[model samples]
Every structure is written in structure tokens, then in C-alpha cells.
Target: MALRPNPTLRQRRLGSELRRMREQAGLGGSELARRLGIGPAQMTQMEQARIGVSPERLRMVASACGCSNEPLIDALARMTSERGKGWWEEYRGVLTVDFLEVAELEAHAERITFCTTAYIPGLLQTPAYASAVFARLFPPLPPREIETRTEFRIRRQELIRSGGTPLHTFIHEAALRMQFGGPSVLLDQLRALLDDSERPGISVRIVPFAVDTFPGAGENLTFANGPVAELDTVEVDVSQGALFLESPTDLANHRAIFSRLDATALAEKESRDFIRSIMKEVESSNA
Candidate 1:
């Protein structure tokens, strides 16, 4: 079968790994190109994820770079070799590139931690809440578009629930209380959270509004762990743009914030009950 022209998330990730490895090895673009028998421009494009890498070429570059990390290399090889359409491919041209990028990241992440302020995190939202969210954001999206985005959000959550490992999420109280999608949607979303909380490998905690201060600065943050490859990435989402961090210092800072957030959050059981309380309030209002 002919390989697809557009790169999948896995392929793009491999490209990122190659570039990171080369940079860590202290080789400049020109120097790396000379060693790999490739032009510098090609090397740049490969590193930027503008092109898919070949397994043989990847190995050759790895060998030349003196990278003996077999597991990492093997993972990259497999990622590069993956040749199929991903579900998210259907959303191309319909959704923003940023949304697509996040979906790709979620697909590869074995573990995820996130903090939200304005709305429920996509992975944990119920379809109704998700719909309401989209309705509010676009206000004019056709029914079909609303449904598409909602489905996309739910599918992202499945990455954790249907997999060998479950995703972990920590939500701030402010986000949980704002009640997007109104009472009914919020009630359903809370119920879904409670249901998922009982599953193995999934941990949901609520950070209280009384935490005083946190390291997340002013926006939502996500930390993704690639368990097999032992890679950790921290993503900070701001109004301006999303920031990706891989440095130890950056990771440590995010870790500290997470730890504090986790510590101060309502206990697991209490958090569920807290959500139950909200559900009751919503139901009472509806009645």
C-alpha cells in the first residue's frame, strides 16, 4: 500500500525525537547534515516535522549521532512506520490546526495531567457539556459542526479509558463550579466524572479555590508522559498561544505545581461527594 502523504502524530513525534537527539548531541544543522549525507535544509524540515522519516535513515542518523538508546530508537522507528489514517484526519480543514495538534499529542500520551480554569477539560466533559461549550464558543456553528467537535472531545477521552493505561486529571474548583452548558449539562458531566472516578488507573481530583497560589501562572496546563519512551512534556495554554516545555527545569516547575494542586485538592471521596452536591442542586432547580 502507498504510504500517506500527510504525517500522523506518531510520525511527527518521531521527527521531534530525532531533532531533540541531534540537538542534545551538540551537532549543528550543517554538521549533522554532513554526517548523515543529507542536505541541511532537508535536515531542518525533518526536524520540524514537515516530512516523514524513513526507518533506515533514522537508524543511520541515530548511529552517527552515537545514540545507543535502543528503546527510544525502536519506538521512533515504529512511529515512523505507522501508515494509516487516524480518526482525527477527518477533522482536517474543519477544525483549527491547534486543536488537531492537541489531539495528536493526546493520542500518544500514556499519562496526562491538566488544570482548567474557564471550562471543563475536553477529555472529561460529557457530550452535553461539550455541546454547550461549543455552542458558547462559536455561537453560530451549525448543528453538524457542534456535533463533530463534541464527538472529537469524547474520542480524546477514550484514549485513556479504553487503553491499557488510564489518564489522570486534576481539575481546579473554579472550573468545576462555573457550570458550563447550564445545570443539566453540568449535572451530567459531574455524573460522568463520578463514574469514571471508580475505574482503575483514572484519578480525578478537585483543587480547592483556597490554594492561595499556584505555579500554573494564568492559564490551563497539561503534562503528558510517554511511558515507554520515558519522555515528559509540559504544555501551558495561554490566550496568546500554547507553550511546549521539555527541559528538566520546566518539568520540575510544572511538577511542583501539580503536587501542590493535588495536595490541596479535595480528597477523592470528598470530591465525588462535592460533585454529587452540585448534581443535587441542579436537579432541585430543574424540579
Candidate 2:
């Protein structure tokens, strides 16, 4: 049989700590498990992150392994607690794991930045606009499924409201010009953008077509800032799929690109005026 790939982020973190504990004690998996009074397989599972390790179990294991690190145990406990069912759990059966992970990450992110080159980013999309986009991508989906996805999208947008830290979007001028649902729907969406742009926490910068080249112009990117002290993560959307990056070097690269994009984008007041210009054109077409 082919060997499976390495574990995920949360898994790898947990596994690394467990492996360190075993190494410190100079004990292999079976030896450590024997000392901990658990089956070797169980201990192996914990180290591989194939199974969830409770705070109590982790503490006991650490103790048996001759490791008494309170801070490490506490961190593992927090991870265990956070592994409980999240708001995205309901969509697990239907949505891909990749999509689910993104949703969960977004929920926990203290701040998010998105650069869109095509359609409006999900957090900024109107219901009508979202519906149109989803329909095109999921042509055979039933109306109910479409509604469910739309509702989820709307719920996701709640993260950007005044009640919470808002999502910052750097929208390209081309996205504002594209009428997804129709001219009327696009008009309403732009009007919503105008109103939302006034929000203090929410920053919307428009990258004009006339502006010189920038990194975001070629691709889309999402940055999910971790807890205050933790390093941030950057996800670059590619044609194949979304790539989650956590390396310090990659994160720094994306941060720099975002700064450059911000510099190239229109100033706040200018962006609002540009949005107004498009809104006016929408009105003219309607009239």
C-alpha cells in the first residue's frame, strides 16, 4: 500500500510535541506506551494525531514520559477544546474538507484581508450576487442547496459587521464593473459597497484599471491573522486549489505584496468616489 501523506497543521503541532516528549525520555513508542499503561497503538495514534488527545490524557502521558511542562500541556488542552464541533460542522457531510477548514480558520481569525481580481470576495458579496456566482459554479445544485450555500455566505459576512472586527477587502475595479445577477443587482451591490465603505473598521480600497501592475492583479490572496502573538497565515488561491502557507518567509512575502498593493490602490476617498462613478453608470443604464 502507498504511504499516506503527513498530517495537517493542528495534527503536526500535536505530534511534534508528543515526539519530543518520547525523545526526551529516550523511549520508543512501545516503551513509552508501556510506561503510560496504554496500548502502543493508542500512543502511536496520539503522536500521529490520528486521534484526539484529551488534556488529561496528554498530561498523564507527559508525566509518564518524564516530561512535566505545564505550558505545553495547557496549549495541548486548548487545542483539544477547540477541536469540538464548530459552526461549520453542519456542512461537513456536503462540503469538501478544504472548504470546511477555510470556514473554520476564518471564524477564528482576528483579522482577514482579501484581494479579488474577479468576482467580489465572499465576505463582501450581496445575496443576489452570491446566488448568481454559486449557480454558475454549481449548475446542477437544487434550489435548496443553493439557498443553503447563500445563507452560509451571508452568515460568513457577519464577521465583517460592526459587532466584530471587519474584513478588509482590496477590490479591483474590474470586479466592481462586472454585473453578476444583472444591472439592477449589480447596482444594489455597489450601493451596499458605498454604504459599507463608510464603516470605520471596514476598509475597501479600489485598484483602478489605470494603476500600474501589482501582485494582487495576477492572483487572489487571503490573510488570516492568528491570535495576537501567533504568526499570521496566508492562503493564495490558485487554479488547482487554495494553498495555505504558514512559513515565516512566505508570510513576510505576502505581507510585503499586500503593502505594495495598498500603495498602488486608490486612496480611501478616491476609492469611494470611484465606486460612486460606477454606481452612477448603473443608474444611467437603469434609467
Candidate 3:
């Protein structure tokens, strides 16, 4: 009924799908609005996610648009009502919006493939490790700000362990030994990685120095597969903010990047052994 100032990423995605369906069906804005008994302005608002669309209305739209994929239609229906805000909503004004969107994507993603070269995967970082990583910001953040970010990151990890989404994370070996928060912190972080690697629906791989060469900085990203292939999203974090890529070309390119990284990475078992070896080295150094 009321307009939203900022729709969540999921809501925008639902809107995007409706637009895609209309386009794929070769329906025009005015014609679709005519068929659905809505004004072009309202159609624009609904398709832009500025206004909410009911599940009934969403189904009506899909039916009018000729999108017949049942599973996708069902997924789209679920997005129509994003009842109850997610945990990330708590930080709406407290943190940057882009980061919150990234978290929301992670939460609803059916499958996620993350490729990192410098930093440990956010979903896999320990509080201390995340704190240390967050501490290195260029302009620097206040202690309270850092604490907020650390908490947000820790919360993001819950989605992976929640038993539905599958995670395939590729980390550069250098990240395992970066000594963030000091030797003890990094040691604990690596041990945490070892523990997480063994979890169901979670796959952690390492791109070791032995790989020699692989994708460069441009490839560092998180590709979150929505309920369906067409809805997939790619997120790239930068110093200033995060970039959310949803165009078909962007998704395809990032998917290719992940495939290469996946191939370059050591097998899951070997990756754990690799992490264990690094942890032992850190442990021995402290002893």
C-alpha cells in the first residue's frame, strides 16, 4: 500500500524477474498493465520494487507474461512477500546499504561460490579475524564501527551452517598465513577453517602457491545463485563500497571466473591438509 524508500535486494530481484518475464514474453509496458488492470506508473513502481506486489498479483503477472517454469514461478511467489525483516535489517542505518544487500543475497542464495585472493571469506572469518581485517580500512573506522562490522560478518556465516544453502569457497593460501590479529588469532582462524571444511553442504578449497598462476584481482568475488539460474547475482567488494552485478553477461563472466578458480584450487581433502599444515606452522611459531 505504502511506498518503500529502499527495497531489499530480494524485493528488487522479484521485480527484475517480472520485468524479464514481460520482456521474454514480448509484452509491452502499457499492454501488460492493461492486461493486469494496472496503470503504467503502478506497473513501473511494482517492477522497480518501490511498491510491494502481492503473491496473487505476482502470479497473475507471471501468467499474463507467459513464464511457465513452475519452480521459478514458485520462487518468484515466495519473494512477493518478504515477511519479517532479516537480521541484517537491524543495521539499516548503522552500516552501509551495499554491505547489507550483500548479506541479504547470501542469506537467500541457494548456492554460493566465493573466490578470494587476499582476505579470508567473510562467511568463514572468526570474530577476531574479521576484526583484524576490518581494522585495516584506509581512512580507518572507529572502534564501534569496527565492532558493528565484525558482528555483521559473524552473523553472515550462520546462513552457511543453517543446512540449506551450499557454499563453495576458494581461498588463496596466502590468506591463511596473513597473521591478522596476530599469530594466535590467525592460528585460531585457520583451525576454525579446518572445522568448517568438514561441515555438510560446505566446501572450502585453497589455491596454493603451487598453482603458479590463476585469475587476477578482477576475479575476486562472490557469486550467489538465486533459486534459479536466471536470478543469479555476483558481488564484488571494493574499498569504497560493494558492487552488485546481475546482468546476464556479468553473471556469465563471474561464473567462468569461479570455474577457473575452482579448478585451480586444491581438492577439499588436500585443502584441509593444506590449512592444517599452515596452522601447525603458526602453532609452532608461537610455541
> For each candidate, what is the lDDT?
0.76, 0.78, 0.86
Q: Which candidate, 2 or 3, has the higher lDDT?
A: 3
Worst 10 residues of 2 by lDDT: 1-10
lDDT of 2: 0.78
lDDT by residue (tens digit), candidate 1, 189-280: 88888998888877787766777775563678888877553467777776555667776677777888888777777788888887787678
Instruction: Find the number of clashing residue pairs for candidate 3.
Output: 0
Question: What is the TM-score of candidate 3?
Answer: 0.91
**Would you estimate the TM-scores of all the predictions?**
0.84, 0.76, 0.91
Among the numbered candidates, top lDDT falls to: 3
Candidate 2, residues 24-118, lDDT tens digits: the string is 78989998888878899887778877777777887877788877666656766676666456676788767656665677678767789999988
| Candidate 1: Cα lDDT at 246 | 70
> How many pairs of residues collide in model 1?
0
Question: What's the true lDDT of residue 31 in model 3?
Answer: 94
